[model samples]
Target chain A: MAETRQTELAHADSRESVTPLGPVRRSRDLRVYLVVLGGVMMLADLSFIFWVAPTDSILGDIQRVFYFHVPIAVMSFLAFFVVFVASIVYLVTRSPAWDRLAQASAEVGVVFVTLALITGVIWARPIWGVWWTWEPRLTTTLILWLIYVAYLMVRAYAANPNQGARYSAVVGIVGFVDVPIVYYSVIWWRSIHPSPVVGPLAQANALEGTMAAVLLFSFITFLILFVFLVAQRMALRETEDRLGGIKSAMRRRAESVF
Target chain B: MVLVWKDILLEVRSRELVISVLVFGLLVAVVFNFALDVTPQRVTAIAPGILWVAFAFAATMAMSRAFVREREQGGLEGLLLSPVSRDAIFLGKALTNLLFMLLVEMVLLPVFAVLFGFSAMSFTLIGTIVLATLGFSLVGTLFSAIAAQTRSREIMLPVLFFPVILPVIIGAVEASTRAIGGETTVGLGRWLPLLAVFDALFLVICPWVFSFVVEE
Candidate 1:
């Protein structure tokens, strides 16, 4: 255990030294990627949001919200699936790297989920004539939001660092399972929300050509941004771990000197 | 099975968890009476929800005691080190909790009925309560085990539990609503199957996940 600790300390120290001047060498490529990807999403959000979709009388121009809303919701679900997959991988391999990946993805999933909820409400206010309704889709989304928020809180307030990862990983796995149940329960319970768009092919064919292109482009744009966010967050987490190690080392050094 | 009996025996001797849950449940019923301003006609409609809320709240209190006592007496680690399977530990604890919750529910049912002027002796209502409580206790026990590891465990248990088990509560209350209102077929048709499904799912999943959460 002592030898392993020493090697871990040395590895972290060397990585820190190599990236001392820049914003941490580990995150450099990821940061550049995120900046570029974020720029692409912003452009897409501006262009297709107004230009692509036809407006309905009841919904007004607020149908534009679908461009940003649907993509974020889809990406959030995808991000959580990654968290679930990574959690299973971590449990099987007992690898800290997989745990970090799961944690990073969960954090990004929360961000996108929040954006989904906000944009959803924005769309609902005009379309449904209410800011919030206990409609099945809305209710399930709210529950999903609560679950992920609780996930974040569990990790934040956990007293024992080692136990935190394991406990939160289990939560990540179970929480992901709940997502599908939530989706289906809404349908099963029979609320006012519209049914899912069905198959990808049917969904694509339903949209106008330009609208389909724009929506697909926005989806790709958000996917890239999601990856970039995960990478950046993982790099920051690595830096925080290094700083924690350094603090422990400093404490040990002071104790030895005294 | 013998280990599960041992847990019941321990609880019978101590009476700490059972007494506390029973009293807490009664208090919740009393509070709901004044809060909801229950009239005779409305009582049947509201009784099912009140019963569940009281039971759920009291169960949260009871579950906090589930592992804390073991931890305080230094029994948990010793239990883990024993030859018994971990699932046995989970089963024992969960069964014990189920019994305690039922004991509380048994008392609360009559008191709530009398206070609100409703009948508690109906067979269908009894069946719905049994199914709902079983599902609640099963999931509650699992979450209690998970929360026992955390720092603010008492608060943590409910936070982790309520959202996960909301579907169970919904199914139970809906079923109980139908049963209490004398709509026997509707109660069994919709809620009973849901309750059974929830119970089955938790019983299978919780034991598999318990070992992971309980590891030090």
Candidate 2:
């Protein structure tokens, strides 16, 4: 029994030391991909906002909001969806990779959601004649933003690493469920925001010319950007984790010498 | 089931949660009186919303205690080790919290009526409060469980919970408004179904999610 206990402790220590190395390698590769992808998205967003869409369409100059607003909104929702899937993956597999992915996605989702809120206010000011309104979509989006921000807070303040990740995973999963309800509530209640333009039959029939082309390109560009951001953020997290491990090891070594 | 009852019995013996919630609810009702420019005519119109705000905030205080108490005593881990299903634990706590919140509401309703010169006997209004409280407590119980696992749990619970449960608040307030305005059938028609839907959705989802929140 004594020998078996000693072996188990040694095995656990060895596993802990080696685990960070795998994530570090994976993170480095992801950083390279993200940098390239983010660059492409930055350029695409610039072109769409400046050159592609007509400055004076029938929707008026307010149409400028569409370039930033739509893409950010799409990216935000996509980021949250990633959180949902990553959360499920984390819970089922108990893998740190999924946890890291969920955390990174949540952080990116917050950024996009913030942008979406800002662009929304700017759009609303010109179109609705107000900077802020208690309109359903606006309210729901604002609430969604708060939920993720709170998720971040929970993760940051958790005393233990495992505890933080697990808590945030549950929050991410619950918050994702709220998104569909928000969408549905906006539909159920009359709202100042326009109804979803991309319904089942209406989606194909709705987009015909340059509008379709620009929107599709913008979405793809944003999707790539989302992937890039998550990759970079995940890399940063891995580096932090490694630094944390190193600090603890150095502290232990110092204590031993003392 | 026995464990669930045990938690309720434990809470009953302590009585801390109930007393604090009732006192807080009464204070909120008093504040609403001055804040809303209370007059006999205007009082009836706004009374339901005021009552709900008091109950909801008070219930939040009560709900935070649900897990924080167990965590403080270091009893939650032991509870998890027991044979009770995780869902039973969730539902048990939620129902107890709901009952406590409703009890506070019951006391506050009479207090609100007396202060605002409104009637407490409206069955529809009472029903609205019941459904709304259930929905709020259900969602709150799940979130409190999640929040209790974090370091800054007490502070984080409301921040995470209130925003997510906005729909419930809206439905409740709207339904309460209809009932208070003396539009009985339409108000019941509108808010009751929404409250029921909210309750059903969270009832199914929160328990399934509770085990994941607590497992680690």
Model 2: CA > 4 A from native: A1-34, A57-60, A183-208, A249-258
DockQ of each: 0.50, 0.61
Docking quality category of candidate 2 according to DockQ thresholds: medium
CA lDDT for candidate 1: 0.75
- Model 1 per-residue lDDT tens digits across residues B1-216: 776677778888988778877888888888888888888878777888898898789878988788888878888899899888888888888888787778778888888777777778877777777777777777777767767777778778888777777777777777677666775454357556776776787788777777877777
Q: In candidate 2, what are the lDDT values of residues A1-118, reduced to their tens digit?
A: 6995566445444544526467678767776777787687779767776787665444476766776688889899889889999988997898887888999999999999999999
Candidate 1 Cα misplacement greater than 4 A, ranges: A1-27, A51-54, A182-207
lDDT of 1 at A109: 90
Q: How far is candidate 2 from the true structure (C-alpha RMSD, Å)?
A: 5.4
Candidate 1's error at B195, in angstroms?
1.9
Instruction: Supply candidate 2's per-residue lDDT for A111.
Output: 97
Which docking category, incorrect, acceptable, medium or high, applies to candidate 1?
medium
- For residues A113-218, could you state the per-residue lDDT of candidate 1 as single tens digits? 8999999889767665677766566677787777777777777767765677777777777666665555554444543234433222333245666667778888
C-alpha TM-scores of all predictions: 0.87, 0.87
